[model samples]
Target: MPRTLRASDTVISGNPSPACTEPVDGEQAEQPVLGGAPSSASLDTLIQHLVPTADYYPENAYIFTFLLSSRLFIEPRELLARVCQLCIEQQQLDEPGLDKVRVRKFGPKLLQLLAEWTETFPRDLQEESTIWLLKDVVGSLARCEEAYCLRLHQVLQALHQKLAALGPGPESLLGADRPISYRTQPQASIHRELLCICSDPYRLAQQLTHMELVWLRHIGPEEFVQAFVNKDPLASTKPCFDEKTKNLEAYMRWFNRLCFLVATEVCMLSKKKRRAQVIEFFIEVARECFNIGNFNSLMAIVSSMNMRPVSRLKKTWAKVKTAKLFILEHQMDPTGNFCNYRTALRGAAHRSLTAHSTEKIVIPFFSLLIKDIYFLHEGCANRLPNGHVNFEKFLELVKQVGEFITWKQVECPFEQDPSITHYLCTAPVFSEDGLYLASYESESPENHTEKQRWKSLRSSILGKT
Candidate 1:
């Protein structure tokens, strides 16, 4: 009484063909297989039942069928396409529904199908679609176990080999100047997906390590380091550098990232000894730049380590000044001595000038030194056991020195000419009570010249005025 199915309707209508002319006995056709007895038309019934739902079934069913069926019996591409679609849809939804859906029921099946597809699929489409799907699946499966993470790593390694064979052309898997537009969509999506996964710290740590390795292999280590460092939101707050590619700013960024990885849960490398080893590794990488006289890079790394501020840093300026004096005393090349002195002076000037405006940079060394000097000379001397010296008493001794130095204004004889007279004439003198002595005068050129000669001779022979 039922309508007969036609060959033309089989694919679309999910029916068996009418070409089988053998008549089914009524009882055999009507009876259900029971007690482990084989059905008369098991294969035909399966094909008929499965065909209708194949296009509309959910991920769990597709994964199940792919694993249970022989490779020859299923279209792997279509199966993987369904898996990818399921992942895309799942990711897009606000509620992931992972708890309601059973990954345990489906995970092994999916992994098995993936392994088979990796061996059998067309190389190009396999590299493009299948590998990407596997990466997503691996990212999903990351919540499972160390074994699954290891399996995903193996898959990625195999995929990378295929990608590498494409050579240096556009087909190459990685290139620095590859258009940002190509990366923008996937990277944005992946970043969001990663953020979601990172809620599970264990999974995130594994995923981060996996991604780091991928980046390291695809790009060189320096570029990998830069990608993380440059992407850091805090980088702008720390320091800015010139546009030069090779500089302290670049190295500092790299150093900071390495430290961040070691110190945080992102790497999960939390032993004190291990951290020290990582720091040592970073220093070794940095030493190459340091050897080329990159003091700025060295300083940046040292600062990032957050080590105790070096006690000897205070004495650095004094040591530099002393070394310059030594060079000068030994009659070394005056130019080198002058250069060394100027370097130290400029460094000191920069510190002092910066401190005058921004007190934060003034370390305790200079502050304490200034405080002690002022206390010893100015503080101790003024508050003597007796009353303060009267202004008239201070002036009396000063007047005597003025008269002794020059009876009349004169050109300084300290040097051969009038040009040097100003310095000699303006020199300060002090009385026995530590009061300052000073004088001012105006005189004709002849008197100025003679007075300056006597004052100069007295100063030179008797020590400075």
Candidate 2:
């Protein structure tokens, strides 16, 4: 890639200094477009236009993560996209093998902020927003000191309680002219419809490919704390922290989306009989994924089933056939440190070795491996007591990261049909409010008080019902 972002000069003065980007004056720069994250040229312009004397290691990006998490922005999603893109660009420029993380320094600071947020229970932000910010902080701090593990667990427990109170959110489900009754539909018809809407494995692989490139990336030396910071001219190949944080954010979002779709689809059935059909539909979805050798979606689908909202539906689960569900869950078993998933992944890798180039398979497990590497990162130091590179520990982590990259080279030969993409993406997404409503309605259909019943009946007539 052509050089675009300027390198920040490191003086090793042991004092904070200002950082700036050298302007890239090029003919390719053009007016910003109407949509999407900031244009590349616009990003360049914005960076250069900043005040000249700002502090180098400022907490702007870290602070932005909190604000972004709160979703108070006019366009929260777009804002996040813009910032992440900027960070990715800077990350690419920091290459040359420093192998250090730029933002890991913010982990402890972010944790402090989260602790305060939890304690004070900031009233200005909605509970849902605080919950999401807590998740973001937790994701970023996975590689924090081992001693903080208990603290982190406590934080999660508190967040979970807060979420139960918050419900899904204030927004209700959107109106559909004709709410399809999955219960009334025959299993075969439902299966046929699902077959039509099934995601193209190739397109799914492409998404994984995009994530793997950015997520599995290594960072540089300047990104690390002073203890691990080596100044040897040849000692500059450490990994950056941005890649891990971004990857974690992306991975969790992706998995949660799949989970959301699964839970929402089942909950939205509105009829008790069809709930079983939803479970069966997903079971087949997982089965077909296995047949196609797409481990990524299989993990996602299975994980979705295991979420509390879905698991709490004991009546629904009792109606589901356990054979396929058991096998699939066993396949992804996290026991003994995911021995089964690792074995399955390796077998899938070996099987795809000789498959026709046009029919090649891609297996990407987003959650497990990333979490494993995070454990590795936290378990050992990258440098020894004398500040020498602990290549042994480093190499082990590198081996795991390298597998995602290497396996990614496998070709996703099938061209994605745009129609298939649209069909699969058409599933209605639920917010916090929707999930809570669905869970309550499913769990307690007849438990409403007489007055509550009349109100619900009235609301139902208006579609809010």
Identify the leading candidate in terms of lDDT: 2
List where candidate 2 sits over 4 angstroms from the true fold.
Answer: 1-248, 358-362, 423-426, 443-465
The CA lDDT at 335 in model 1 is 41
Q: Give the least accurate 10-residue stretch of model 2, judged by summed lDDT.
A: 1-10
Per-residue lDDT of candidate 2, residues 280-358 (tens digit): 7777777767655667677777766765556656677777776887887877776666667678777777777777753
Instruction: Write one digit per residue (lDDT tens) for candidate 1, span 298-382.
Output: 2233333332111112222122223322332222112432233235334543454434322111111111222222222222221
Candidate 2: TM-score? 0.47
Each model's TM-score, in the order given?
A: 0.20, 0.47
Give me candidate 1's TM-score against the actual structure: 0.20
